[model samples]
Target: MDLHEPVTPFAVLDADKVATNVARLRGRLAGTGVPLRLHVKTAKSVEVALMAFDGTPGPIAVSTLAEAEAFAAAGFTDIVYAVGIAPDKLTRVADLRERGVDLVVLLDSVAQASAAAKAAVPALIEIDSDGHRAGLAPDDPAVLEIAGILPEVRGVLTHAGRSYYAYTPEEKHRVAADEVAHAVRVAERLRAAGYAAPVVSIGSTPSGHTPVELTGVTEARIGNFVFLDLVMAGLGVCAVEDLALSVVATVIGHQRDKGWILTDGGWMATSQDRSTAQQKIDQGYGLVTDLDGVPYPDLLMSAASQEHGVLSVRPGSAAELPDLPVGARVRILPNHACATAAQHDRYHVIGTGSRTVRAVWPRVRGW
Candidate 1:
C-alpha cells in the first residue's frame, strides 16, 4: 500500500529511522557494558521492541501491566513494570510471574513494598534523581526502610525526567551523569545494608543518548528514542531530520486571507502535548512537513480543534505559507512522539527516504 492509502490523521513510522535510532543508542552504550532494558511505554509495540533489541526479546521496562502482559504473551520473559505498583495489581503481576515471566515491579513507599513482599514479586526502589516526579531521594532513610520490607529487592531505578529541558550536550551529559550517580548511589546503599539489590537502572532519551559512565548501572530504560519528536529535537537530543514518527493528514480547507491551512488532523490525531513550549523554539502543536517527510520552512500547526489542525507560517517569519489546497496531503511531526502515537492504533510503516508503506505495526493500548 502507498503511504497515502491510509485515511488522513493516521500515524506513520519510518522503519529505517527507527533502526538507525536504535543503533545510535546501542553504539553509544557499546562500551558502557550496561544493557538497555528497552522501555515499551512509548511505542507500545512488540515489533518496535524487537527492532530495538535487534529482532530478539531481551530485558524490557513497561509503564503498565497491560504492556507487561502483552509482551509476556509475545515471548518477552524478562520484564519490569516500571510504574509504581498498586496493591490491586499485585495479583496480575503474580500471575505473570507464575507464567515464568520475571516481571519486576517498582515502588517507593513501605506500603507498596509491603504489598510487593506479600505478593512475592521482585521489586526495584524508585529514586528521585531530579525530583521531576515520583521516587524517594537517593539518601532518604525510606530507601533502607523499603528494602527491609521487601523480600526480593531487585535494585534501584531513576529517570532523568527533567533532562528533557537540557538544551545543550554538556547539560544533557551532566543530567545523565547525575541520573546514573543517583541510581548507583541508592543501589550501593542497598548492597551495603546486606540486600542483593543488583539492578541499578537509569535513563531518559536525553541521558540514553549522552555518553555517560555507567560504572555501577545494570540497565538503561529508553522509549521515546525509538520515535524522536520535536521535543527531543528542541532539546538537541536529536536532529529534526531524525524524527521518525509523523501524522499523515489531508488539507481540509484554507484561509488564505488569514494565512491558515486547515487539515483533518487535529488534537485528537496529533495529541494535545505541547512539550516543546518550554524549549527555546516553541512548536505550537507540531511542525508541518510534506508527505515525503521534508519540513516546510517556518510552517507550524499553530492551532487545532478536535478534528481540525490550523497550519500557518510561524509568527514574525517572512516566509509565505505554502500554497496547499483542499485535499492536499501533509505530514505533521509531533511535539511528543509518545503522546501523539497514543492517539493512533497502528503505524503505517515506511522505509527511510521512501513513501511506500511496507508494513503496519499495531500498538497495544490500556493500563
Candidate 2:
C-alpha cells in the first residue's frame, strides 16, 4: 500500500510481525507451565490484544484503569491492572467487576489494602525484585501487613525493570533469575505466614526473553514482546526485525544546506522519550526506515519540534540519502514502543512484510 495515501504521523503496525513476536515469546516460555499474561499497557488496543493472544488463553495486564475499562467493554473478561493501585480507583475497579470483568489490582501498602477491602477486587502484592520501583521487598514486613488488611489478596508480583539497564548477557540473565527468585521467595514467605499466596508472577520484556528459571511461577506478565522498540533491541532482548511497530512519516521538505530531511512526524507523533540515550546506542529520536520498513541504520531523527522531525545522517557514518526528495514517505522505528504508540489514537495494520494497509485498529489513551 502507498504510505503517502494515509494521513501522515499515524502508527503503522505489522500484524504478521506481531504474531511472530507472540509466538517467539511463547516458544521461550514453553514447558514452564506458566501462562503469558500479556501486558496490554503497550498495545492499548483490543484489536492488537486479540492478535497478541490470537490462539492463546491469557489475561491482559493493563497499566491504567482507563485501559482496564476499555478492554473490559471490548469483551476482555480477565485483565490484570499491573500498576500499583491508587486508593481512589477502587470504585472503578469494583464497577468493572460488577460487569463480570476480573480486574485484578496491585498493592504495596496497608493504606491501599484498606481502601480495597470493601471493594473486594483481588489484589497482588508488588515486589521490588531488582527494579527498585514502587514495590515492597520480598521480605518486607509490609507484605504481610498489606495482606492482612485485605484477605482477598491472592499473589505476589514483580517486574525487574533493571533488565532494561543491563549491559551484558550475564548481567541480564542474573537480573532475570533474581526477579524469578524474588517473586518465588515472596510467595513462599506469604504462604508460610498462612496467607494462601497462590500466584507468583514476574515479568519485563528484556528479562522475559532471557535464560531465567520460571519454576513454580504461575504467570509471566510479559509485554513489549508484542511490539519491541529501540530500547528492547539496543538491550539485546530482541532483534531489530522483530519490531512490529513504526511511524509512517512524510518528508515535508529538505534542508539540503544542512543535509537534513524534514518530516511531519515530530515529538507529537513519536513522543519525547529518549530512553535509548542510556543504552549503548542512542537513536536520536528514532531510526529512519523506507516506506516498506527496511531500516536505514545510518539515518536518525536528529531533532524534533511539535510538528517537525528532522532526519539527518549519523555521526561517524558514511551512509547517505542524497535523493530522498520532499513528499517521500518513510517509517520511523521508535525508541520506546509504548510511549510512541500513546502519541497516536489508531494503528494502520499492514500485511506481514508488506506495506499495504490491511486494517486500522483504534487505540485508547489518557489516565
Best by lDDT: 1
Which ten residues in a row are the worst by lDDT in model 2? 49-58
Q: Please give, for residues 1-367, the per-residue lDDT of candidate 2 as tens digits.
A: 4556888988999988998898888888885767888898898888878876764435888998888888888788888888889888999999999989888899898888988897787899999997468899788988888888884868998998788898799999999899989899989988888888888888889888886778979888888989999999999878888889999888899888898999999999999999999888889999998888888759999899999999998888888864777788898999999999999999999966677788889988887
Highest-scoring model, TM-score: 1
How many angstroms is residue 7 displaced in model 2 relative to the true structure, after the best TM-score fit?
A: 1.4
In candidate 2 the C-alpha lDDT for residue 21 amounts to 91
lDDT of 1 by residue, 1-367 (tens): 9976888989999998999999998988787888888999999999999998878898999989999999999999999898899999999999999999999999999999999999999999999999899999889999999999998999999989889888777888889999988898889888989999988989889889888888998898999999999999888888999999999999999888999999999999999999888888999999999999999999999999999999999999999899898988999999999999999999999987788999899999998
Give the true-structure RMSD of model 2.
1.4
Instruction: Give the residue spans of candidate 2 off by over 4 A.
Output: 55-57
**Segments of candidate 1 deviating more than 4 angstroms:** none
lDDT of 1 at 242: 93
